[model samples]
Target chain A: MNITVLLKQVPDTTAKITISGGKVDENSVSKWSMSPYDEYALESGLQLKEKTGGNLVAITCGPERTKKMLTDAAAVGADTLVHISNDGVTDSTHVQKLLAAAVRRFDSQIVLCGKQAADTNSGSTGPGVAELIDAACVTLVTEVNYSEGKFSTIRPSNSGTEKVAVDGLSVFAFDKGTHELRRPNVRGIMMAKKKQVESITSGDLGVVLDSSNVTLNSQNPPPEKPAGQKFEGAEHVNEVVSKLRNEANVI
Target chain B: MAYEALDFYDVDSLLTEEERMVRDMVRDWVDEEVIPNIEIACREGVFPDEWRVALGEMGVLGAPLKGYDCPGLSYTAYGVICRELERGDSGLRSFASVQGSLAMYPIWDFGSEEQKNHYLPKMASGEWIGCFGLTEPDYGSNPGDMITKAEDMGDHYLLNGAKMWITNGSIAELAVVWAKLDGVIRGFIVEKNDPGFSAPEMKGKHSLKASVTSELVFQDCKIPKDRMLPGVKGLRGPFSCLNNARYGISWGALGSAQACFDSAKDYAMSRIQFDHPIASYQLVQNKLSWMLREITKGQLLAYHLGQKKDSGDWIPEHISLAKMNNVDIALEIARVARDIHGANGILDEYPIMRHMANLESVKTYEGTHDIHNLIIGRHITGIQAFTREA
Candidate 1:
């Protein structure tokens, strides 16, 4: 069983962002690393490939500079890499269509992706690709097991939890907080340089999806969260709970 | 300007991919195997004897020297391995340096082919541990005033002397004993099982508690004449080994300094005082900036010196300069880092105190800070200032 993990390179979460001149300042972003959620997807792919005798392919959709993430993934034991070099595409629907067209050329049996990209938080690609491929889709999946030509997925649901079994090939959008990512050893990173990385262009796929649906209105910094209120003594617990239920309205 | 341009020297790039891989492997091993047990080992004041064979299996015993079952890595990579191992504990790095630089180097560089073939492989595999016996009870900084002697016994040589502060002496299976044979200093490989040989542990050591230091006594010890090193015969033989160990000290000091700096930096950011993090204060920032500057400079110096050694252009005076600069800077960084931690720095919970204690030994061992300064002074002024008799 050949596994293909779709990884999206996002800015490091620990990076301190600065806003100046009505735009995000790139100078403040010091280092580039793999997105936290996508790291889980990469770990899952490596684990599955290690357990089953198969090849693990890492696919990314971004600009040319994003190849570093692919190279890092290869260092962590990804057998192959596919980079979809495109200029600009913010619409989730357009990205899904493009990736689906490109993935159709490969012999991918299990497709894995993060639930959302950290930059935009648009959790629509997994379901979109499942729709394009006409396969069963599982979102927010935390655990996955494949045996006897079937895929068993465990994921959280609105009503408690749920488990679903899908036949044949499938797509899974893994949620964060599933498991801690493993650090790659030096030997593994050295061997990764020799791994095969095949770069594919959207034009080569012979399909141009419609990207006219969405337009960028404005990009700005998110407002900082308010400092949390501290409570002291047993009497304040009742007040805090009341405020959380009535004033904050989160409970 | 530009946040004082804090330098995290890119010394790692000087190494080849394979060499860097060896460095990273040992770094991981030290972090996993050594760091976790360091506190316990230091508290017990006993070295982790189990890691000897394990470290040998990892190719650390004779990592840089080529041939005879050694790892054959570059000098830069060996420096990196030393730096990482010392980051966990200087005692651990001391074990590797003594085995690789002091003991194995002499046999490989000066020993007969038969001697090299006999001892190098066993020492490399950790099947036999080795120590270099050079520092005598009377000779610490000055090695020329030695009284240890070896008398010719036809087929065998009778050796009589006592060596002090010898690392790995108590546990070593073989010892590379340096003694004066007919007014000429030479190296002789003496097995521990040899008659009239004894290594007793030195007690009451406050620093480098996790390493074994012993007094090697050779009372009429008879060693085979063939074990005598033929290529080197003089003070230069042991001085060259001392140079090698000092080169490693240049890099090892940086590891301890970096660890202290990192701890202090983290503590300053999170530790609260005056209703705000200490990092917000200019005074704390000043201390941190100073440490960063020193660490950066020391790292760059060690890296370049390692490159020089790799290219076979390194001089003894150059090594003295590096050793002098890095060890002094490391001791200062440890002190400032401890001051930033305030009362907590005195405790072992923070590594500043431990590093502060260990740097004491690092400063004194191989060559003291004052000795190295004299070496640099001699190079500049064309006069040797270390000897008052002259």
Candidate 2:
């Protein structure tokens, strides 16, 4: 059994982002952390490896600075790591192409990626890779069990989640609805000092950048919104529920 | 800015990867499990004993020791754990440090193999609670003049002593008691079940209210002949344990100071006065900047000392120096932080007053602030101050 997980280092969602020359000014970003949804993807990959008895490989696409996420992945039990160093990658389709080429090199039987990279919020990579590679794709998956060339998955549906079983090659992009993110313990961190993250260039992975696929769009900060309604006490429970059900359409 | 709002020096970069991992695990656990419920415990004057087993499961009790089922984290990691635990509440850190450095360190350092086999594993697991009884009712700054005595009998020693200001005293099942035997001081393992041993809770302490304070009483207490620690003699045995506990206090006090400074920074930034935020005032900036500067220095001191401990060349005076300087500075920071919070600080809704109160006890215990000064004072001068008196 083989599992390949995709992770991205993004500016924290709460970081104050600023734009210069139509691109994000890195100075305003307070810190870079692993995309929250990617943690779930890595956790699922680790759990699947635990159950099925195989190796786990974490792969990421970014500059040399992103190597910390690779080492951190190794600290949390990734058997090996691949860093696709390419600073010019921003297109979701290009990410899919580069990832598909790397996944082919590993002959990865199952692929796991975050549903979307938080920085861009363009959630096309997982399905994009599945489309380019011609494999079964499962989106917004929360739980997975793999054995004997098959996968049992749980993903959110209309009203609730549904369990779906599938066989053969597949891709699963995750949400944090289930599976608590496991922090790397001290022993694992000590072990990571001996493990190394292998580097592979995007060019070596046979990623041909199609210039036609690249497009520059307008970039602006999200608009400010009105304050939310606050309801307190047991007496307002019905009113709160009514607002949620009718006004906000949450319930 | 980096989670705690006081680490302007990026102290986390100085820690090893394992140390940082241990710190984050304990810090997150404290934020989620300890902080929300601690104010209630402090206001009601009760120790949150419920977390003891959870702490054991987290592998923190006796975590730095090499064996006896201990976790064996590096000394720096242990210090980070103390820092995070005390950031929640000092009482919790007191319980853990007493269990690890004070109670368990001695048995591992001096006890017989039989004694270690009997108690170390259970104590490490929090299956059994233990307390140290070095600070007696009559001896606070001068433990050498302790009147507690253990007279030798053919079968056992009859012990008579009273240990005050003992943490975890009333609740503990065992105690490592320091008493005189054959006109020389020795360490004895006294079980609470011993016929003449009793521990009663000391009451009405305005400071350290969230921790268990008690008086350890021994009236003709009988112990088996083999229960005495066999590895070392005299004050050397207990003094080593005190050094370890004091090292932890140097780091733990910084946590309290950091928590207070964090609250003060947040309060100053938000509280409106004189038609603008109070943070815009130069005086408020002066206090906040000083606190940040002092907290950074204290953290660096502890980090380097922790490294020295790891390399096994740590001078004993450095422990006293750190305990003296860090606690003194921390108490000052806590006071200023309370003033920054103003009326809101005196209430339990904020931790400034609680930490302010706990630090008062921290300063006096594990060797008082002045006692540490004299310890350092003697180290440089080759003179003993307390012994030369009278």
**lDDT of every predicted structure (CA atoms):** 0.82, 0.86
User: Per-residue lDDT for B114-153 in model 1, tens only?
Assistant: 9889999999887888999999999999887787889999
Candidate 1 ranges beyond 4 A from true positions: A1-86, A89-200, A203-251, B1-41, B46-73, B84-88, B103-131, B144-162, B168-203, B210-233, B265-289, B388-390
- In TM-score terms, candidate 2 sits at 0.87
Error of 1 at A237 (Å): 10
TM-score for each model: 0.73, 0.87
lDDT of 2 by residue, B235-293 (tens): 89889999898899889988898999989988999999998888999999999999988
Worst 10 residues of 1 chain B by lDDT: B1-10
lDDT of 2 at B319: 97
lDDT of 2 at A88: 61
Best model number under lDDT:
2
Model 1 agreement with the true structure over A1-251: per-residue lDDT tens digits = 77888888776665666767776666676545577677777788788788786988788888776786787787678888888876556677767877787667677888889888887788887899889988788888887777888888888888977888989768999887366676554335556656656787778777575547687566688888889989989979889999999989999
In model 2, which regions exceed 4 Å deviation? A13-23, A147-149, A210-220, A224-251, B1-4, B44-54, B57-63, B67-69, B113-129, B151-158, B170-173, B191-198, B219-226, B387-390
Q: Report the lDDT tens digits of candidate 2 across residue range A65-149.
A: 6887777788788988888876567577777888888888888889999998889878888899899888899999998888666
Give the C-alpha lDDT of model 1.
Answer: 0.82
